[model samples]
Target: MRFIFKTDYDQDVRLAKHGGHVFWYGLLLLFLLASPWLLPEYWLAQLTFVLIYSVVGLGLMLLAGFTGLFSIGHAAFLGVGAYTQAVLSNMGWPFPLSLACAGLLSAAVGVVVGLPALRVKGIYLGIATLSFGFIVEEVLARWESVTGGNGGMHVKEPSIGAWKLDSGEEFYYLCLVVTVLSTLAIVNLLRSPTGRAFVAIRDSEISAQSMGIHLARYKTLSFALSAALAGLGGALYAHKIQFLSPDQFNIVQSIDLLLMVVIGGLGSVHGAFLGAIFLITMPQLIALGKDVLPPVIGQAPGLQAVVYGGVLIVFVLFEPMGLYGRWLKVRTFFSMFPFYRRGMFKRQKSFQKSDRLK
Candidate 1:
């Protein structure tokens, strides 16, 4: 196994911990830079969706994974962002301004939702968010003046001054830049004191409060940050799809976003991207399965839903830490070689102080 002997705080908080990390990440960057030229147009569009979903997954991960908050209506924030961009763009606003407005609007709504969240926990919090999502969907459909209602609205291609990111190749570069920047920002945030506060809240609220962390402030901040990221993703998605509809941001979409983070891994940034990739690619895998299976089974009406539910159940029950956790196990096993023990990664049974007292 590789080991680091740190001499200073700089090394402790360095983004790349080792020379190996820099080399591998650099190679990955080079591959991403060459992707547009290497892949077909259709695959490029798929890659764009993966990046967009990754943004959404990151938002959910921030709250659910990092801050111990549960939300089932993040799709509402995403809808708000999409509608904000579509409305502003149609009113002759610049793409950048519209996108910024989308994030701000979503954050405002998140604050409102978070107010109720402060008083609730667990299933009640989920119900509150779910209700908010329904309200947003109703507004999108009934308020035809703003959202175009059930008919939907079109989004113009994003452009900066004279340069337009209208083609698949051009848009891929835009997504790549945003994704990299966002990933770096999150990595930095997770290393900061504020990030430590979030982890504290996740581990134990009483302990975090005793340590001088304001529960209300940090919880609200988490909601706002999560909503802002979802909004940004929604804005990009609108421009990429060139259309917006209330149906697109319903409860189902929110569930899918949750699945992305849960199946990828909670409390890890890398898990978000891994989950997004899995979500985006699962449908294609099912399509491929159709050719191998019998016609009747392949043409089954609810097969996709069944497969999705099955996969989710498998991950939740068998791999509680998700795909990223599995990767860690494999990596550690190889690193330790014959020295690895059978129960090295087993979950330990333990009780919290509150639980023990009770």
Candidate 2:
């Protein structure tokens, strides 16, 4: 009888630890919704950028975290989505429907790009995607009218019936909705068996193949789905920023997208969202630092970039699991504080004892 009570108590602790994440997510939602009214326009605009970046970051999460793809050219797909929206909307297609088409176009391209994944893995594949992103940018630049040449293309404001999303605050709400929806989609996908298969493939493609998972098909689909989500984010960004430059969707942005997933923590849906907000917010904070610094750092604009690079290096070297990983550890420690004596208990033992109740 006493053992049964212990098992139930441990199970309750484990459940609360996992369940608390939902509460934190809810709090974040309320904060994002209130930001436009609560923060200055500049700050609100940054937050809106975070929402857009989060969508792209989620795609990176799907590829790198779940599938272990290590892709750096994810933004090429973003450009594909944005350019499609720009060209179609300019051609007088209705805005809402065209956005959906943009996702399809990006997905189609992703399937083609994903073909190489059947043969290549690791850094070689990363370079291949990087090359693809460059090619896409070049095409956008050389294509003249479709992409408006190197001068770039201007995008129409997004509209729904009588409503136009012109104000940053209005756009903020749009981005917020997309961010929330994209994260939910990722969560649902991760919970599904297909998502589990992707994780399996990530860990061992050979084993997964032996276990009856179709390698080429799942690989292609994961790439397509990731690109489709990136495209969705890009389409929204095109509408929000009111302009589309091929330069904005180049390899640099792709690397930045990869960095977000890495810095946020791979394999974590919440990490993608958290990373986007941090990466977006960090630059603005750095800019503020430049203003306050006396002279040494201000003389060299490169210092900011250096600092950013250094931070990424540190995270990669010491905390490859990223900030979300650290957050998990902190939660674990605090949750065990009352019951654990100087951390003497084994992690698996604690976990196993708790699991017996379930």
- Top model number, lDDT: 1
Instruction: Tell me the tens digit of each residue's lDDT in model 1 across 1-358.
Output: 7888998889986789899999999999998899898888888789889999898888899899889898998899999988998898888788888989998999999989999877898899999999999999999999998889999999888888778777888888888887887788777887789888988888888999999999999999999999998998898888889999999999999898988899998888889999999999999999999999999999999888899999999999998778987887788789999998756666321433111100
* Superposition error at 208 for model 2 (Å): 0.9
Task: Please give, for residues 235-277, the per-residue lDDT of candidate 2 as tens digits.
Answer: 9888877888889988778878887888898877778877997
Model 2 TM-score?
0.88
Q: Could you say which candidate leads in TM-score?
A: 1
Q: Alpha carbon lDDT of residue 230, candidate 2?
A: 88
Please report, in order, the local distance difference test score of every candidate based on alpha carbons: 0.87, 0.81
The whole-model C-alpha lDDT of candidate 2 against the native structure comes to 0.81
Please give each candidate's TM-score: 0.96, 0.88
